[model samples]
Target chain A: MVFLSFINNLINGVSLGSVYAIIALGYTMVYGIAKMLNFAHGDIIMVGAYVCFFMVSSFGLNPVFGILSAILVCTVLGILIEQLAYKPLRQANSLAVLITAIGVSYFLQNAAQLMWTSNPRIFPAIFGNGGLQLAGGQLMVPYKTLVTIGVCVIIMVGLILFTGKTRTGKAMRACSEDKEAAQLMGINVNRTISITFAIGSALAAVAGVLLCASYPKLIPTTGSMPGIKAFTAAVFGGIGSIPGAFLGGILLGVIEIFSSAYLSTELANAIVFLVLIVVLLVKPTGLLGKRTSEKV
Target chain B: MLKVEGINVYYDKIHAIKDVSFQVKEGEIVALIGANGAGKTTTLHTVTGLIRPKSGAITYFPEREANLYDLTKMPPHKMVEMGLAHVPEGRRIFLQMTVLENLEMGAFCKGKATKEDLDRVFARFPRLQERKKQVAGTLSGGEQQMLAMGRALMSHPKLLMLDEPSMGLSPILVEQIFDIIVELHRSGTTILLVEQNAEMALQIADRAYVLESGRVVMEGVGSELAASEEIRKAYLGG
Candidate 1:
């Protein structure tokens, strides 16, 4: 019985981790190229979830259409936010950018509240509420969990290939390393950054949909906790590394799940954060961060 | 052909370049020799559109184009598209990228690098070709300089501006780099060479300008300026 419960918790942890992984990828990529902590990224998730929720619930559209529209809306919103809010402050101090991001986050949250209200709406299931029975009904895997894990895997692979093979991807990498040098090489640095935001936001939409599907609760603040967790995952893995975010998210999710399942559910968040603090103390650069050395 | 007619640049309240002017004709190497703070790099930066001048008309006449372009109105990438390449100071090659990837970035304006472009760069620097897969940060100082030049050449630039190419290299390596510069000059590329090493720069230059405290104090033929007592006393350790 204990073994079966462990297996069940592990699957749940992985499913949750997959969602965090997808969100963390967005955080890491934006952080890598733009060199700013976009606190509003979390609010983008809220907006995306709301978009998906309205499409499916109000319009009675197919789940696929809802998901696609969510991604499209989020992508456009991401670019718009970057151009209006971030672009003007490109030359400003880092603290100014952070504050602006926070301001944007609040604006998005309040805007959602005005539109959708703070009453939590139960999210419709895109994947059917069903499960696969294994070990003679001793263990069961939900379709939602399986699909979430599969989608996350696919997204990760696709992202890796896109960045490794494409010209725009290489240019993005170049900008991340040195924007001035990249500009001199004829790479449009601004365009690359905008594209980064677009991609990050699109991924945020997918994560939002999945998160809402799994949790079955949608609200203005639905995305804040997950957004913060994913950001933590990014920092845990290595803030600017793609693979680092993935690893960090998975580990964080597993830790959170195990703490909740075995220990007190209320202490799960605190435990997760405590683990992060200890990890950071042991390795200041996080698990996979590169140690930068200045050349004289 | 390129012309800079009396450009003034300021870094905040400090005047960095004071009404500086110089010209590089087709198929010639023009050397700008100066001390650390004399603004040789700033002149190159201004020409490449990295820095905007407060007042001056910097113009470029392409080989086939009849009209002269106002370089001050263009961005640095646009300047590169117009066949000007600046091998910046300190060999700012992308450290995390491989040698081949850095060269590929140089050809970004061209969409994609043809096999010929790769061949040409590889022929010039065999070391880069051999170590093409290695990350750039792992390369030695001299190899990095060669990679920087090779990267610039990938753009097929009509005018190549090299800033302090011999910086942080051994004496023998400096000679080798100068030899490559002379070879490139011989192959019909206009060159603007900036260096603190006045002795080596003048040897391969067609015309030379001496800058002191952001002002061009002298301009003459390469060998003539090399022999001048003032230049030798100021730049060359006499």
Candidate 2:
């Protein structure tokens, strides 16, 4: 019975980690290209979840359509936010941009509260409830958990290929390295940044759906914990590195779940942060982060 | 062909370029020789649209085409698309990317470059082809310079502007860079080279301009300037 429960907890941990990984991808990509820490990135996931909820519950649409709608809405929203809020401030001081990002986060939360009301809304399962039985009834994992893991794996692989092979991907890497040089190479730096935001938001939509499906609750504030945790994962993995975000998210998720399962549940959040502090103390650049020598 | 009228540029409160003017005619190698902070880079940046001039009319006349462009109004990417390439100072090659990837980015405005195009660049710098898979940051200074030029060539620009292509290079590497520049010019590419090595630049250039601080101090035939006692004492370090 202990072994079965451990296995179940491990599955739960992986599912949660995958969601964080998805959200972390957005944060890392945006930070890598634009060189700005977007604090409001987490709220994008909340907006996506809310969009999905409305599509399913109010419009009586199929769950897949709801997911698609969420992605579309979130992508447009991300691009709009970048153009309207961030573009004007591109050449401004980093501190000013950071404060604006925090302001945007607050705006998103308040807007969601005003539009959807402060009450927590129950989320319907995309896939009907219950576990997929493996090795008969002794080992059962929720279909949602399996689906989440599978989706995460696919997205991660796709992202790897996209960054490595495509022309625009090369442009993105170039832009991240040096914006002026990338422009000299004939890349439209502003357009590239917009694309980065659009893709990041689309990934956030996937994370939002998976998160709401597992937790079964949605509120304006639903994004805060996951968003902060995902940002932590991004930092722990090496803030600008994509694979680092993946590894960090999974490890964080596993640690958080196992701690809650075996140790005191109250200490799980604290322990996760403790581990991060320890890792940072040892490696200031985080795992997989390349140490950059300051150019004079 | 490229032309620049009176242009002023400033960085914050500090005036950088003061009423700078020059022109690069078709099929000519024009050298802009200046000392450190003499505004050679500022001039190139202005032409590339990396830095917009405060007041100037910079015109680009495309060969075999009736249309002319006011480059001052355009952005860097558009300037590149209009067949102007600037190989910046310090190489500025994407350090984390592979050599081949760096070259691919050169052709970004062109949409797609054929295998023949790749081979043409490879033929010019065989070392780049050998180390195509190697990370660019690991390459030596000479290799990095070659990669920077090769990558710029990938765009097939009609006018190639190089900013201090010989900076920090060994004598042999500098000679090699000059040789490649001459070869590129021989093959019908209009060259606008900004160099601190006035001796070599004037030796190879068709026409030359001497800039002091931010102003154009001298303009004439390259060899005539190279023979001048004032030019020799100030720039050529005789």
Candidate 3:
């Protein structure tokens, strides 16, 4: 019975971790190519979730269509935010850009609150009750968990292939390395950066739906916790690395779930942060980060 | 063919380049030799559309008698598309990318390079071909320099501007680099070479301009200036 419970918790931890991984992919990609912290990135999840909710509840659309609409909306929103707010400040000091990002984040949260109100809404169970049972019904995993994990895996694989094989992806990597050099090479750096934001926000849309589906509750501020955690995951896995984000998210999720299960439930959040601190103390660049030295 | 006429550039309150004018006829090697901060780099940057000069007009002639296009308003990418390539100082090859990827970036102006072009670049710099899969940053200085030049050539530029190609190279490597420059020039590419190594610059150049304190101090045939006593003392290091 104890062994069975451990497996159950493990499954739950993986599901939770996969969601964080999805969210962190957005954070890392934006940070990597754009070189901005993008506090507004987290709020994209909130915007996506709200969009999905409205489409399904008010318009009686299929959940799949609602999810697609959310992706498109968030993608456009991300590009608009970058073009309007970030592009003008590209040459400005880092501090100014950071503060602007924070401002954008708050603006998104407040806008959502104004539109949807502060009341929490329950997410409809799109997948019917009960999930696949394994080992003669000894272990029960929710269908949402399975779906979230499955989606996360597909996205992760697709992203790796996209970045590794595509021409635009190469241009993105070139831009991040040296914007001037990329420009000299005939790349439209501004266009590349805009595309990067679009991809990140689209990923965030998927994450938002899956995250709310698992929790089954939505509020204007519902994305705050997941957003922050995913950012943390990006840092833990090395800020700019794609695979690192994936690894960090899964690790953080598992650690958080296991801590909550076997240790003090009240200290789960504290434990997650504590692990981050320790890891950072040991490896200043994070696990997969390359040490870069400036040349004269 | 390219022409710069009375171009003045300022970095905020400081005038970095003043009334600089020069011209490069087709199939010629023109060297702009100067001390550091004397505006050789600034002049090159202006020509490549990386910097907009406050005064004077810069023009490009793709064919000897073709329409001359004003280049002052073009962006760097557009300048590259118009068949100009600048290999900036410091061997600014993408450090994290593989050598092949770096070369691929050079072809970005054309949208893509044919396999024959890639093979030609590889044939010119076999060292790069051998280490094509290796990360560019890990390569030695000479290898990195080769990658930078090979990348610039991938665009099949009609005119190539090289800024201080010998800046940090050793004596032996410097010889090899100059040989490559001569080879490239011989292959029908117009060259605008900028260098602080005035001796080497004059040896390979057909015509040269001497820039001092943001102004053109001397202009003559490369060998005439090289033999001049005053030029020898000021730049050729006796």
Best by DockQ: 3
Per-residue accuracy of model 2 over A1-296 as CA lDDT, tens digit each = 89888888998899999999999888999999999988888999999999999999989999999999999999999999999999999899999999999999999999999999989999998877898897678988889998999988888888878888999888999999999999999999999999999999999998999999999889998988899999999999999899988888988999999999899799999999999999999999889787764221
- Find the 10 residues in a row with the least total lDDT in model 1 chain A: A287-296
Predictions ranked by TM-score, top down?
Answer: 2, 1, 3
The residue-by-residue lDDT of candidate 3 on A134-164, one tens digit each, is 8898888889899999999898898888877
RMSD in angstroms between candidate 3 and the native structure over all alpha carbons: 1.5
Model 2, span B64-169: residue lDDT tens:
7798899988988887788899999998999989998999999999887678879999999999999999998889999999999999999888999999999999
Task: Give stretches of model 1 more than 4 Å off.
Answer: A294-296
Model 3, B1-238: lDDT tens per residue? 8999999999988998999999998899999998988999999989887788999999999885567789998877777778899999887899988998999999987776678889999999999989999989889888888999999999988999999999889999999999999999999999999999999999999999999999999999999999999899999788
Q: For model 2, what TM-score does chain A reach?
A: 0.97
Docking quality class, candidate 3:
medium
**Model 3 misplaced regions, further than 4 Å:** A293-296
Interface-residue RMSD per candidate?
1.4, 2.2, 1.6
Worst 10 residues of 2 chain A by lDDT: A287-296
What tens-digit string does per-residue lDDT give for candidate 1 at B1-238? 9999999999988999999999999999999998999999999999988889999889999768898899999877777788899999988888888898899999999999888999998998999999999999899999999998998898889999999999999999999999999999899889999999999999999999999899999999999999989888888887
Error of 1 at A209 (Å): 0.5
**Candidate 2 overall Cα lDDT vs. reference?**
0.92
True contacts kept of 3: 0.64
Among residues 3 or more apart in sequence or in different chains, the pairs in candidate 3 whose N, CA or C atoms overlap within 3 Å are: none
